[model samples]
Structure formats: structure tokens, C-alpha cells
Target chain A: MSSKAFKQPWTLRTASSVFVIAWLILAAFPFLWTLWGSFKVELDFFSKADWRNALTGARTMAEHGSSFTGNGYSGAWVQEEFWRAVFNTAIVCFFTVAISLTIGTLGGYALSRSSYRYTFWLLITALIFRAMPPITLVAGYLLPFFEWNLWGILPTTIVVLVAINQPFTLWMLHSFFQKIPKELDESAKVDGCTQFQAFRHVIIPVMWPGVITTGLFSFLLAYNDFAVTSMLLEKENQTMVPKIASFLGTTQTEGNVMFAVAAVVSATAPLFILVMFFQRQIVSGLTQGAVKG
Target chain B: MKHKTFFWFILPTALAMLLFIALPIVSVITQSLFTPHEQVFKTVENCTPFKCTQSTTIDQEATEALREAQPLGRFVGLSIYLDRGHLAFGEVAQAWQSRDGFGDFFNKIGNLPFYRAMAFTLSYTFVVTPLLIILGFMIAVAVNSLHRHLKGLVIFFSLLPMIVSPLIGSLVLFWMVDSRGVLGTGLQWLLSNPDLSLKASTGLTWIMLMVYGVWHSAPFAFVVFYAGLQTLPKDTLESAMIDGATRWQQIRYVVIPHLMPLVTFVALIQLMDNFRVFEPIVGFNAEAHAQSLSWFIFNDLGGETRLLSSASASSVLTILGVAILLSPVLIRTWRDFNSKG
Candidate 1:
């Protein structure tokens, strides 16, 4: 791909480099700044006198006797009991991913293998479902959930999230399954294996790459969700994102905004690691739908 | 596959979507038409002395019984949709009759809660979608031009904003742009307006949200466009260059035509997403200045007295808006599928 014709003149190269650098800063700076500010005292973080105080942790020095402090982390984790939300988040993400992938794999594989006209309709239905904002559905859930005593529980929220995630998970996995050769499964079936057995034995082994990618996305949908979790979960059963939101209500007046900041950083850490490890998969997953279009 | 086998295979997901996604839309529509029962009132007369006063009191038992009997409340038809909190048909008529001009009529309409949210949602969707596409294309081209070793690092950093939860991403930016925070102070210093506050003005708040929207979604466009660029026909590009076309001209003619489908794809997805922009309003604490339709519904549902009817009406409207926005794509998909089949 690298050819002599592709070579850029100095001015264009400089401009491109400059633009990329500027974009990189815009992309990465806020997270970096917030991570730095999370260690500082509130006064220093939202310093009224000078913004540089945040960089230097001037108030943090006066208050905690250090430029770097774990006070916010401790306050959020121990004092605010943010670890409970973390635990709940772990449970929700794990279960949502597991269940979504289980059902999504079956449905997606069936859609890909079948030649029926219904398959197209089902995929289109999923697309329409995907586009409906989850919040609109939340309004529907509240009444029924309250009546059935299904409100404010972790399991209910997990199921709701899995349901909300199905449209996307099905779409992604269906595209992926479509890419695999039909002969792989058809050959296995000719040996007299039942459909489920064929999928279980032959298709399952090779399906991991696609499953893992879909699972990553399911985990993200559950993890990054605010609307469904916030509305559905009980206060005690609240996940990290909603827990952070709840902090704004209670902690703002107490001058403990740093607790929220610390919690935000803590919640983001796993995603950071996920992206670091699964960069290729994440990129491919995002482009999968577009490529199909 | 046999129909029975297909049914068995698809049953679980089908049930989930039907029960949760499909039924909810029905529930929302039903709920939208129904208003919660007004508190049952009883006028009780108490005679003590010469002059006695009679006061009307809410009949707790009756109201409780009423609510218990019919959990969905009394059906109000489309009244909720036409109320002041929603379409405000009456108010629009009044405004139209009294308006000096279109601007004045629009000003009145803008004051309505539903219209206000619609205005912001539409503006944000239209403004952010194109800007993000252009910014994303530029970034993709730039990153594609970079040395191979640096490409991974640039791509990793670029994906950060999009990958982070919209709420957290916006909160991070919101903190920075707080009047006392870094960017806020930087802007003040640049403009030489010590009193300038981004949050305090409507125009600035709208711009801030749109900027955050673009920042958050651009990486998605970049990644898709980048992938499209990988499959670009190098021979065509070479031929264009050989024909005395400038680099820009080659991109204009060759590169863009190849990526046109991807651009449509990105724009369609972005339109659907940006229309439902709710998290940033909460994250930025910008609800006071800007309210999106989703935010409007969230506000109704989250309050102490959940305005179920109001929220449901808004949900129905929002769903209709989505259907309208997605009709073109749906029709196109249907056409393509029919042709292929």
C-alpha cells in the first residue's frame, strides 16, 4: 500500500501530523486531567484561584500533606461503600454477557444458516429494536415491575439489560456467523449428528472468536448503561454507574466531589484494561455492522 | 433447517425481545392514553356552633380502592398528548393567533417543554452528525498517513472518548469546563472575559453539548472510515494521480466515492444515537439550560411523583420520532432484501 505516489509533500505532512497531534490531545487530555485531579483535594481540583493549582495539588498538600493522595479512593471505597456497587456491577456484567451470548448465539446461528424469508424480517426487527432508546422502555417496565415486585432487584435489571442487549448482540453475532462457511456445520451434520449436537460439537469450537467479541460488547452494554440500571436497581443493589450518579446528589453538598471522581476513575479502569487487551476485537466489532451495510 | 428446529433455536431470544422490547412499546402506548385517577374528593359538612364551614377532603379509601381496582388509571384518550406539557395544541393555536411574526410564534413554541426538547434534539442531531463525519474523515486520513508504528498508539487514544460511557465521558469534560476548571479558565483568559461562564448561557451550553457529542462519536466514524480506506482500490488512486490529478483531487474523486456508502452508514447510525441524547445532559448538569426528549421523559419518571402518563406520552412521541427518522433506512433495507432474494 505504501507507494511513491502516496508520498505527501512537506506542508501536507506537517499539517496532517499537527492535526493528528491536536486530536490525540483532545481525545486523551480529559481522562488524563481527571485522573490527575482525582488525587487532589476538592479545592485544588476545582480550584477557584488558579487552574494550575490542580496540577500542583496545592490544596491537597495543605489538607493531606502530599501532592498525591489516596484519600479520595479510600473515601469512595471504604467510607461510601462503593465496593458494593462494584460487586453488583461485576455480577450484572457477568450474567448479562453470559445470558445474552447464550441466546444470541443460537438465534444468530439459526438466522445465518436458514434460507427462510423470516430470517430477514427477524434481523430487521432487531434493527428497529436496537434503535429504540432504552429509556423509553424503562418507562414501560416501571409500572409492571412495581406491580410484580420485580423492581429494585439485581436479577431483574440483569434480565432487562440482557433483553435490551439482545438486538445488538444478535445483529453482531449473526453477521459473524454469516462469515463462517456453511460446509463446516453441514459436513458435521452429514455424519448423522442432530442440529443441536452439530452446533455443540463442530460449530461451538470455532465460534469462540465471534462469541468473545459479542460477549465483549454485551459486557460493555451492561457496564456502560445508565438509564436501565439507574431506573431499575434498588439503592443497595445499585451498580457503579448509578452509584456514581447518586454520589452527585448526596456528596456535592458535603464537598466530597472527589469521592465521585475517584469512583469514576475506578469504574473506568476495567474498560481501560479491556480496550488495551482487546483493541483489535473492539475495532472489528465496531466496523462489523458498517461493513455489512 | 426445519421450522421446528428453527423455532427451538430462536425461541429464547424471540421471547426475550417480545416480552421486554415488543410488549413495552404496547404498554407505553396504552399508558400514554391513561391518566392516573384524580384524588376522590368528598365534601364533608361539620356543624359545631352557629356558623359552620364545609370543606372538601380527598377520600383516601375511595382513591385507594380506585387505584387498586384499575392499576392503569382511567383512560384519557389522546388528551395527555395534547396537554401543555406535550404537544400543547391549544397553546400553539393561541400563539399563532397572537403572533406578530414567525419568530414570535416560534419563541412561544420554544417555551413549551416538549417543543424545547425537540428543538435541541433535532439541532444536536443535525449539527453533530456532519461535523463528526468530517472530523472523523480527516483523522482517518491523517492516521492512515502516519508511520505504521505510531498508528496503533493514535488509534488507541482516539477510541477512548467513544468507548467510555457517555455519562462518564461527558462528566469528565463537564468537570474540565466548569468555570473554575482548566478549559473554562483557559477560555476566559483567551476571551479576556473573567466573568464568562459556559454553563450560564444558552448558546454556549448548546455548543458545549454539541462539542461533547462530536468528541464522543467521531472515533466511531473514524474507525469505520479507516476500515473502508484499507480496502480502497490502490490502482484507481494511482491512475488518478497519473492523470495529473492533485492529491486532494484524487481523494475528492477516488477516495470519497469509495467511502460514500460508509458515510451514509455512519450518518444513519449517528442520527439515531444523537436523537436520544440524554446522558450528557445529566453528566454536564446542563438540564437547566438544555433538555432533550429522553431527558424530558427521564425527568418526569424520576421525580418524587412519577408522572407516568406524561412520561409515557413523551415515550410514544419519541418512538414516533425514531420511526420517522428510521423510515428511510427501513425502506431501503426492504428494497435491497427484496432485490437480493
Candidate 2:
């Protein structure tokens, strides 16, 4: 496959190299620009006099006596109390992932082990549930949650997110469990262990890789959610994405766009770290459904 | 697995989906059929020496009590669905009767909120999906040709757009393209029009959003297609080369055919995803120029007045749209399952 016969012509090689380099710039430049601009004052970041001031941070230097200032970060994190949203986000993601994976693992394992036709119907139903946008369901939740005195709370939002996360979590884990052979658990069962005991002894140890991958996705869905978290959670209990959105509504009029800029960077940092650490698992999880189907 | 064991094992998740996903859908339909109770009005006679006058005033307590008694509101049947918000059947009929041509009719229909949203949603979904596929395949092919070490770095950077939250991604791009931001200023300079703003115009806004859509999603397609490329059959490629097939010819005949199934897989997932495009519209603040069904529902649900009935109708309609889009994949899955069984 690596033979000289398969080597590309120089013209084609150059063409592809140029295209890939252009794409890399397009993909990576925005985040880099935003991170850099987030440190500057709003004027320099969105410089009306000159765009180069954004790169040089000229007004940022004039205003704060430094080329780069943490004014936006301080303003967002302290003055606006963006840290509360961060705290709420952490709580939501933690609980949503924990609860979703718990029920999803048990259900997915059952579906994978069973030969019944009902399992097929369940997976198909999950597929349908997964396709419906989360926002559409928000309308139904409002009346009930208001009536039940459950609206505008972290726990309610967490339960809803976990429910919404279930379909994808179940599907991913179902496929992953299918990949693990039936023989191991069967052998344990033959040795006088009950079904639950067989699963506990034989399956749990080998399930970490798949579980971790699925858990990463669950974490992402819970973390990146804006539609459900915005509508269901109270202003005091808002998460990072919705908080950033709220910042836009008020902050833009107050001439404090830098706060939103700083908050966006703050929200994006964890995802950057997640991808950095779990690149392999993320890639595998994405292709898992495609390849298997 | 025995029925008892399986039932116990699946109960928790099944219950969650039922209570949350399935029930909300039913609730939405029910809410959509019912409109909020109208304020109760009481007529009072004011007696004067010269004349008597009658005044009608809203009975706040009575209205509140009525609403409290029946929180589901007054059942309006299908009126809400056919109203100006959801399906806009009346508006469509009016547009059709007064139409000068197909373009004029479509323009009139596009002015309706629901149809306006549908236009953008459908166009965005259709335009972005194939372009991303092509871009993704190109990246996959180019990266596959690269030295092994460079592949890792390129992939790491490539995943960033897709990995970040959509709101954050759009906001990041939105700021960069602000009239005074780098790309915005660059465009102003290049076109020699300092007044040009991407956010101010409908055509540019649509293009900007679709660009964001492709940038955010191409990585998923790239990763999938790259994996497909890894499993390419070397024997077929070698034979094609030996038979004097050019590189382009080999890619056209063999590589593409091999990757066709994966293309369909990526397309199905992207269609589902792009049809629900919501966050980007908010992040870009281009709601004035473009609206999606999700955004329409969000607008109805947000702020001082919840407009629950209107939002619910939109939800039911959006769910129907999703079902239509998803029908092909569901049908394919059913056929595959039937054949296997």
C-alpha cells in the first residue's frame, strides 16, 4: 500500500497540501482569535478605529496599562457571577451522566443479551425519541412543572436531561455491549451464578472502555445543552451556555461585550481539554454507530 | 433473558423515556389543541343624573379562578394549528388566491412565520449536508495522504469546531465577523465597502450560518469518512492501477463505491441534526434575518408571556417534520431487521 506505485504526482500532492493547510486555518483560527481577544477590552476586541488594534490590543493597553488585561474575565467571573453558572453546570453534568449511565447500562445490557422481538421495538422507539429536538419537549414540560411546583430548579432540569440523554446513551451502549461476546457471561452463569451476579463478575471489568466513551458523550450532551437548561432552569440556577446567552441580552446594551467574550472562552475551555484527553475515545464513539450500521 | 428479569432490567430507562419523551409529546398535542382561557369580562352600569353609561371591564379574579379551575385552558380544537403561527392555512390560501406567479405565491407564503421558518430550516439542512460531506471527504483524502505524524495534529485541530458547544462556536465566529472584527474588516477592505456587514443582511446571514454549520459538522463527516478510508481494499486498488486506471479513475470507481454506505450514514445523522438548528441563530443574533422551527418554538416559549399553546402547536408540527425526514432511515432499518429475522 505504501509502494512507490501508489505515490501521488507532485502537482496533486501540492494541491492537497494547500487545501489541507487552508482548512486547518479555517478550523483552528476562530478559537485562537477569540481567546486572544477575550483578554483585551471591548473596544480593542471590536475595534472601530482599526481591526489591527484587536491583534495589538492598543486600547487595552491604554485603558488598563497593559497589552493584555483580565478585565473581561474578572468582570464576567466576579461582577456578573458567572462562576455560579459554572458551578450549576458542573452539578448538572455530573448528575446527568451518573444517572443516565446507570439506567442506560442496565437497559442496554438487557437489550443486547435478549433475543426477544421487544428489544428491537425498544431500540427503534429510542431512535425516534432521539430524533425529536429537545426544544419541542420544553413546551410540554412548562405546564406540568409549573403545576407541580417543580419548575426552575436544578434537580428537575437534571432529571429531564437524564431522560433526554437516555436514548443516545442507550443506543451507544447497546451497540458496545453487542461487541462484547455473550460467552463470558454465559460461562459465569453456568458456574452457578445468577444473571446479575454473572454480569457483575464477568462483564463490569471489560465494560469500562465502552462505558467511558458513552459517558463522555453523556457529559457532552448535558454540558452543551442550551434549549432545556435555559427554559427549565431558573435564572439563579442557569448553566454556562444559557448564562452566556443571558449575558448577551443585558451585557451588549451595557457596552460590556467583553464579558460575554470572556465567558464564551471560559465555557469552551473544558471541551478543549476533553477532546485533548479523549481524542481516541471520541473518534471511536462517533464512528461507532456509522460503522456498525 | 427471562421476561421477569428483562422487565426489571429495562424498567428504569423505559419509564424515563415514557414519562419524559413519549408523554411530553402527548402533552404537547393536548396543549396545542387547547388555547388559554380568555379574561372574563363584566358589564357595569354607571348611573348619572343626566345619562346612564355602560362599561365593560375584565374580571381579574374570575379569570384567574377560571384558569385555575381548568389549567389546560379552553379547548380550541385544531384552530391553533391552523392559526397564523403553526400551519397558517388561511394565510396560504390567501397567498394562493392573490398570486401573480409561483415566485409571488412563494414570497407571500414565506412571509408567514411557520413557512418562513420552514424555508430557512429546509434550505439550511439541504445546503449544509452535502457541502459538508464533500468538504469532509476532501479532508479525509488529503489527511490520508499525509505523513502519519501530521495526521494526529491535523485531526486534533479539526475536531475543535465540532467538539465545542454550538452556541460557543457560533459566538466565537460571530465576534470574529463583527463589522469591526478581523474577518469583517478584511471583507470591508477587500470589497472596498466599509459599510458592509454580514449580520445586517439576509443573504449574507444565511451564508454565514451555513458556513458555521459546515465548519461545525465537517469534522464528524471527516472522521467517519477517514475511518472508511482505513478499510479501503488494497487489492482492488492495486488491480485497478495495474489495469492502467488513473488515480482519479480508481477513486471514482472503487473508493467512492466502498464509501457509499458511510456517506449515507453521515447524511442521515446530519439531516437529523441540521433540521434542528437552533443555537447558531441565537449566538449569531440573526433571528431578524433567519428563523428555524426550533427557534420559532423557543421564541414562543420565552420571555414574559410563555405562549404555551402556540409553542406546543409548533412543537407538534416540528415533530411531524422530523418524522418525515426520519422516515427513510426508519424504513431502511425495518427492512434490514425483517430480512435478518
Candidate 3:
């Protein structure tokens, strides 16, 4: 607000910018490498004689490759399997987020408003499940369920994910609900709303950010899950990440370039899409909803 | 009437939780007791045609029959727990080495890879958590001090990492850290030209792992801290500023004290998560010496023997570890909830 404050040169400003730029470079480099690696060809990968040469000469191979070589970036990105993996990831994420949000919110609301014995029990149970090791649950039961015809690929994977995700969401939402003061409930009732009506009309709007954050977390957990998805899904329903992982040890070893590229693309897509669609809600959601007062 | 309404409202969630969460947990705890010793004895009895000899009676068979005849309720008691799994506590206590399982469980644990993996997992969590926390605090403070619009923007940008799928993050990290990729390539040249060898367990590989972890995890902590910062009393902070408190002074005296409750809360959740970490290690380098308790449990449970008992014992141990670590926090929260009620 004063000219005297501005009199000191822009040194701090410049330094801050430089710092931000350096960190961003380090942080964003892996993503850039992934994007570039996706467009590279296999022969180009192998021609370099060794790892170092391959690292340096990958660009050169890209330049000299045939128009429709079908050997490098083009082959991997444009394939049906790639699209299938993407679809499976979407299916898993969508259902996982949607179901997790519903159950968590409903349970959170009940626990928030109701003073019942089972509410405390439910909360504790949810906490225990939230802390349960995901690997043990999947390993011990997933295959056995399939063997006994209690599960199918898509359904089993979905249920396992839903179970894994529900506890965290419940805990998050419950905490969020706890933060909404009892005065708001009283005021809503005073405004002539029933208990259900009060929760639906009043509490829902207030907890929208919490819901969004919890939903986003659920989405992230489901989407990024490697071990559970790898264990549960049969060949046809195998998700994208594990498919790329499977590519690592095969004769198609040179496929690492495309895998890197795809990894960058895949990693950036969901978060980018989420922020783009729900920027406001996600921002406030992240801040006010998670660390309950 | 009030109690009735509350009961009705809580019923659906309580029922679903009981059947799913409560029942499964109780089953896991109960199943930790029953061994397959009975099943083995039954199979042996049906398979053999050997009849009892008067003077030369088989003590082993008689003991096996006694074990078989033991009640299932007693199985839920101490006896069942004693002989429960492939790696029973009873057997493990008797054996000199760790391998008390029927077959290769000892050899499996003896392998350098398993211990190396456990070390990796511990170090990864140990290293990443503090970095993430510090970065989160810096970002939170920076964002908290900005003008409203910019503060909002910073919060939005920081949450970007949290929203991405974990699968995607690990894959992205794998590519960047590969020998021929960006950072990997830079380091490869440095190593090769200088006659340096990049170790699988060290060199660029571990650095890549740490960076990936810090980048991916910082966002969650940042968002949570930022929110906590917002809820802090503005008047106290303003008064501190007016009283000639430096930013650091204000943070130490005003901000941190305000944030302790939340900091502890986030740390507890993160600790539980870090303790059971599976995704990054599993995704980044499946065979890369990175094994946490969760991964070990999976390996044991997935083996040919499917030693659910051993897995159960391990699970119980993990749960106990978590309970011990969080008992203070849990007790405090429970008390707070009760007082509020």
C-alpha cells in the first residue's frame, strides 16, 4: 500500500520465481519424459546399443522411422488394448467413487445426527476396516471367491475396491459432519424441516465440499490401486497399469518407452479432468472438509 | 420419541456395517484360532486301513485323534490359537529359526530379497513421510499468506496430485526413472562416463522413488493443512502481527499451536497409511527390494499352501501395532465425542 515498500527492488520476487521454476522443473520432468517416451519406436529403442545410447539416441530414431512403421509410439497408443485398459480404469473409478460417496455420506449423516449405540459401534468398525490391510483381504478371499463362483471378474474387482474405499470415505465424511455445529441443525428444524428434510436440504449443501473431497479421494484410491486390481481382474478385464507392468518382462521389452509415455498421459488425465470440472468445489473441498475441527 | 427417531435414522448404516465391516472383522479374529490340524487328521483316518494294535498303539495317532475331537468352541479358545496356522505361535516358539511352517516359509523369509524388501519399505515410508509433511507445511503457509484469489489458486494446484489415480502416478514415476528416460538418462551419462555404476538399490533409482513419493503425497497434506490454517483465529494472528511478531514468531506462537490438533490428526492417518503402503512399491518396482507388512501378508496368503492362519496372525500383529500407535489419539477422540454428546 506504500511506495516505500515498493522502493526495495524486485529481488525477492525474482528469487521466488526462480525457486518455483526449479522445483517445477524437477517435479514435472518425469511427466515430460513419459509423454516423450510414449511417441518413440522399438527399433529406435534397441538400436542405441545400450541403455545410455538409447537414452541419448531415442530422438534420432523418431526422426528416421518409416511413415507407417507401426513399431513405436503409434503402435502402442492407437491399439485396442490401450483403449480397453482405459475403459476398465474408468469403469472401476466411476463405480467406486459413486458408491463410496453415497454410502459414506449416508453413514456419516446418520452418525452425525443419531445418538444410537450401534452408531458408535459402526464408527469403530468402519475405522478398523479403514485400517485393515487391503492386500490381505484381496489375497485371502479374492481367488477363493472366484473358485466358489461367488465372484466374477468385473463384479469381484468392483466389490473389493468398494470395500477397500468405503472405510476411508466414511471416516472422512463422519469427521466432516462432526464439524457442522448443532446450531445449524436446530435452525433447520426451526425453519419447519423434518429430520430427513433438514439433512437433505440443509446439511447436504453445507457438506458439498466434504462430499467432493471424499469422492475425489475414493476416485483416486480406486483408479490408482495396483495390487488389488492386479490380483482380482482376469485377463479380459485387466486394467491399464498392470497391463503396462506385464509388458516390462516380455520380449516386447522395448515397449517401456511407450509405457512411460502412456504413464504420463494416464496419470495427468484424471486429476486434470477433476480440477477442470470441479475447480471451485475441489479447492474448498480440499481445505475445509478433510482435517475436521 | 427422540430416541426412536435416532434409532430409525441410524438403522440402515448400522445394519450394513454390522453385516459387512463388523462381521468380517469378527470372522478374521475368530478364524485366527482354528487350525487345519483337524482336517489333516480326518483325511488321514479316511485314507489309512491300519487298525489299532493293542500293545503297539501309536501315540501320534492317538494324539491326532484327540486334536480332531477337540470342540470348535475350544478351537476358538487357547488350544485352537496355539496350533492355528502353518506358522503357529506354538511351533514358531519351539523352532530355533523363523521357519516353523510345514514347508518353505522359513526359506522364504531367509531369502535376502524379503528382508531387503522390508528394509526398502521401511526406509521409503520413513523418508517420504517427513518430506511430505514439511513440504505440505511450507505450501500451506505460503498459500495461507497469499491474497484470497491466489490462495485459492495455490490450493487448487496443490490438490492436483491427490486427484490422480495411484496407478497412474506409479507408472509415471517408473518411466521417468528408467535407465533410458529423462532423469535416468542424465544420471546414466554421469555414471558411465565417470566409470560409476548405478546400483539397483541406490544411485538414481532410489532418488527417483523418493521424488515420486514426495510429489504424489504432498498434495493431501497441503490441502488438509491449508484448511486447518483457515480455521485458525484471525484476530489472534492479527494481534500478533500488530505486536511486532515476525512471520516466524507468529507461526511459532500463533499458527503452530492452532494447528497441533490437526497436525496430529493428519499424522496419525498418514502413519497408518504409510505403515501399510503397497501401491507405490508394488507399482514402481514389483521386485525392487520394497516389501511392507501388507506385501508380505499377500505373498504368504497367495502361496500354494494358502496359509490363511499365518496371514491372520500377521494381520493381528499389524492391527495391534496400529492400535498401540494410535491408542492415545483414539482415546482422545472417543473422549471428545463423549463429552460433546
Going through the candidates in order, their DockQ values are 0.82, 0.84, 0.34
Q: Best to worst by DockQ, what's the order?
A: 2, 1, 3
lDDT of 2 at A185: 92
Descending-lDDT candidate ranking: 2, 1, 3
For residue B114, give model 3's deviation from the true position in Å: 7.4
Task: Report the first chain's TM-score for all candidates.
Answer: 0.97, 0.98, 0.76
**Which model is ahead, 2 or 3, in terms of DockQ?**
2
Per-residue lDDT of A221 in model 1 = 90
Candidate 2 local lDDT, residue A31: 93
Residues B1-341 of candidate 2 have per-residue lDDT tens digits of: 88998999999999999999999999999999999999999999999999999999999999999999999999999999999877888889998999999999998988899999999999999999999999999999999999999999999999999988999999999988989888898899899999999999999999999999999999999999999999999999999999999989999999999999999999999999999999999999999999999999999999999999999999999999999999999999999989989
Candidate 2 residues A177-253, lDDT tens each? Answer: 99999999999999998888988889999999999999999999999999999999999999999999999998645
What ranges in model 2 sit over 4 Å off? A253-255, B48-52
Model 1 regions lying over 4 Å from their true place:
B49-53
* Residues A255-288 of candidate 1: C-alpha lDDT, one tens digit per residue: 5788999999998889888989999999998889
- Candidate 2, TM-score vs. the true structure? 0.99
- What tier of docking accuracy does candidate 1 attain? high
Interface RMSD, all candidates in order, equals: 0.9, 0.9, 3.6
lDDT of 1 by residue, B1-341 (tens): 88999999999999999999999999999999999998999999988888787999999999999999999999999999999999999999999999999999999999999999999999999999999999999999999999999999998999999989999999899989998888998998899999999999999999999999999999999999999999999889888988999988998999999999999999999999999999999999999899999999999999579898999999999999999999999999999999998
Which window of 10 residues has the lowest lDDT sum in candidate 3 chain B?
B39-48
Instruction: Report the CA-based lDDT of candidate 3 relative to the real structure.
Output: 0.62
